[model samples]
Each structure stands twice: as C-alpha cells, then as structure tokens.
Target: MTLLAIPAPAGWDLDLAHDYDDDLPPAGAEAPEQDVVAPDPAGLAAVGLDERTALLDAYVRGELGRVLHVAPGSIDVAGRTMNSLGVGSINGLELQARMEAALGIDVDLQRLLRANSAAELIDCLAGQLGPEDSPHKSAARRSTGTPAAAA
Candidate 1:
C-alpha cells in the first residue's frame, strides 16, 4: 500500500482505463499499465475506516493508475516500487490534489510536492495536518497504515 493519498496526478485517471486482468503478461511480455481498483467500502468500514479512508483509497488507486505501466487491474501493493521505477517523475501536484480531496481539507501542494515517496506524502500530510486536527487525516492514517510517529 502506497503512503500517498487520493486525487492523483493529471492523466492518472486514464491509467485505470483497463481493469485488473488475470492474464497479466510475463515480466517481459510488454510495457505494463496501471489500473485503479475501487475500494471495498464495506470491508474498510469493517476495519474501522472512515470516509477519508475511502477517499484515500480512491486517491491511491488513482496514483497507481497514474504511475504504473502495467494493466490497471494488475496493480498490487507489492508492485509500487516496480511501478515507480518504470515511470518518470511522479506527478506531485496531481497527488496533492487527490490527497486534499481525500481528506476533504485543503493541503499545501507546494509542501507536498517536496515529498519523494508515497509514504513521504503521507508523512507530509500528517505533519501538515495533525492527526487530531482532522478526522479525515486520522481516518486516512489508519486506513493507509501510516505510523503516528512518522506522521
């Protein structure tokens, strides 16, 4: 699971054009594409997720779509590094917007752009908006599995 939250970069949405497919090509088959699977709300709620969690899930899915080259549906949490390595610079602006949307609060995009990783972005969000300061932030951290100390 990426540390970055929702409303991923520009063109990220298009990455989800294809759904995750079981017939993933072999590692060398072709250039991969990313897909964004919708979150399972019921499952999230069962795990104590809030609306921010759902929003963050969407944002993460969108980021996966934006950054990966594998078929959209083929993305898994384990593939994040591989995906980042395959793409050019991540769209920080896009991700920032998505994160803000997920949190349902405004974020300093300029501050977020400085982060280098998805996890870093989560940390930035947490630092920028204290956990107790925003319910969305609290929920997002729980759902994304971000550590309080790191935040």
Candidate 2:
C-alpha cells in the first residue's frame, strides 16, 4: 500500500489515505474474515498525540459549524481562521468554552486568542496533550507555567 501525505499545519499532518494494490484475486478465491475494532471514546484520553490532534480537528470543525450555523462539511476549517468565520471575542470565548467542555481539558484563553486559524488551534490543543518530551508542551509550559495534561 502506498500512503498519501496531505500537507496540513504542523502537528495536524497525517497520512491516512492509502492506495491499495491493484492486483485482484483469481475467480472463486475465498476471502478471509476480518475483525474491525471501533474507536473507544473512553480511551480517547489515553491516545497518543497524533490521534488527539485528529480528534481536536474534528471537534473544532463540528463546533465551528454549530456556532456558525453552517454545515460541518461546508466549513474549510483547516484553511480558515475563527475570525474569518465572523466570530468576535464573545463568540471566541463561547467556542473555547464549548471545546473545553467537550474535550474535558482546560485551555488558556490567551492561547485561543493567539491562534489565527483552525490548524493553529489544533496545534495548540495537541501540544497540551502531546508526549512529555514534546517541544510543544515545553513551550506551552514555559508560557503558562503549567504542564499540559496528557490526552
């Protein structure tokens, strides 16, 4: 399988798309049963940095859509900033509160203000949940004087 690397903001970059082999099985070939495991919501907090980033991205997109009264899929969250969505300070606070509640994490209001785009916001949240040795967490700790909790 070949993986596709879609360019995204730092920490948000992922290679989820794959190209499967074109070769087909011969006629009448039997296929084996495959077990598919669903993601567990309860285990989200234990997930690694990459998974947390993805979850945060989805959360931001959904919340933005709900608050903006637009379809989640219709919003180009990665490319657009909250300000571009016509969100003011009050709306930004509302969005931040909603995200904190949904993710069960405390995020700094100043960090939210500094984030210029959805991708930037994702990076910020990911840093809080990233590994202990991550530079993102180090930077955040320096700025906030508090280490971020694990996801």
Candidate 3:
C-alpha cells in the first residue's frame, strides 16, 4: 500500500515556531504601520533642477500656463528643450508659491534659496508629506473640525 501525504491547512506551516514553556499571553500581536519617508535629499535636488529646466522651456515655448503641472508622467520643464515665454527671477518666485500651495507645504522665498532646483524641492516636500505628516493635524488638534474615528 502506498502512503499518501495529506496537504496541511492554510497557515499551518509552524516549522519555525516554538512553544512556550509556561502559560502564553493572548494571540495576535499587531504591528503599527509606518509612514513613508523620502530616500534622501539628492532626489529632492534633482527634482528642483528639473523644475527650473522645465520652467525655462515653458517660458521659451510660450506655454508657461502648463508649467503648473510638473509631476512625473505629466508636463515636465526638464523634458522640454525650447520655449519663448521668458521665465525670469520674479516668475520663479511665483512658481514656487504656486507649487507650495498645491503641495500643502511651507515653501517660501527662504526655502527656495535652500533648494537650487525643482527636484530638490520635491524631496523636501516628500519629507513633509510623509504618511504621518498631515497638514490637517493642526486643525484636528484645535478641534476646528471633527474627523471620523478609525473603525
């Protein structure tokens, strides 16, 4: 007679598990979810540079209006090579303010000095936009609005 091997139920692999010598605690210790964090400042720097380049191209092409949308797979200032709109220093500040508002970050003229290009600004934004970094946190603290509690 041939011996047949029966398949174990799901999650029955306990080869790596050990039994406790004494009484055990309740089962299922849940782990906390972590927030997403940016890899490094280098990535941010690259984004900043790319933004500046895209702005220059948009200015030259007379398509500065499209400059507002500069995310990846979208309109890129770095991708375009030529334009005619003339992106001056004053325009850069305006662009920065718009970006800050869109991204919900505090990017002022001083912050702009810290970042040389769009990529770098993106990196900084990433850090501030982490899962735990909620712009609405302050509002929640002040009880300005009620949030639906997690189920």
Best by TM-score: 2
- Candidate 2 or 3, higher TM-score? 2
Q: Which should have the higher lDDT, number 1 or number 2?
A: 2
lDDT of candidate 3 over 1-151, digit per residue (tens): 9999988899888564566634643566433332222233233323544453344233322223433322223433343321222334566566555544443344455554434444443434444433344442221211224432210
Residue-level lDDT tens digits of model 2 in 1-151: 9999856988874565853444755667754332223233335436787887787777677776666656667877666666776666876787777766555456666666656777887777777655556576633333355654422
TM-score of each: 0.34, 0.55, 0.31
- How accurate locally is residue 22 in candidate 2, as Cα lDDT from 0 to 100? 43
Worst 10 residues of 2 by lDDT: 33-42
Ranked by TM-score from best down, the candidates are 2, 1, 3
- List where candidate 2 sits over 4 angstroms from the true fold: 1-42, 131-135, 138-151
At residue 4, give the lDDT of candidate 2: 100
Error of 1 at 1 (Å): 60
TM-score of 2: 0.55
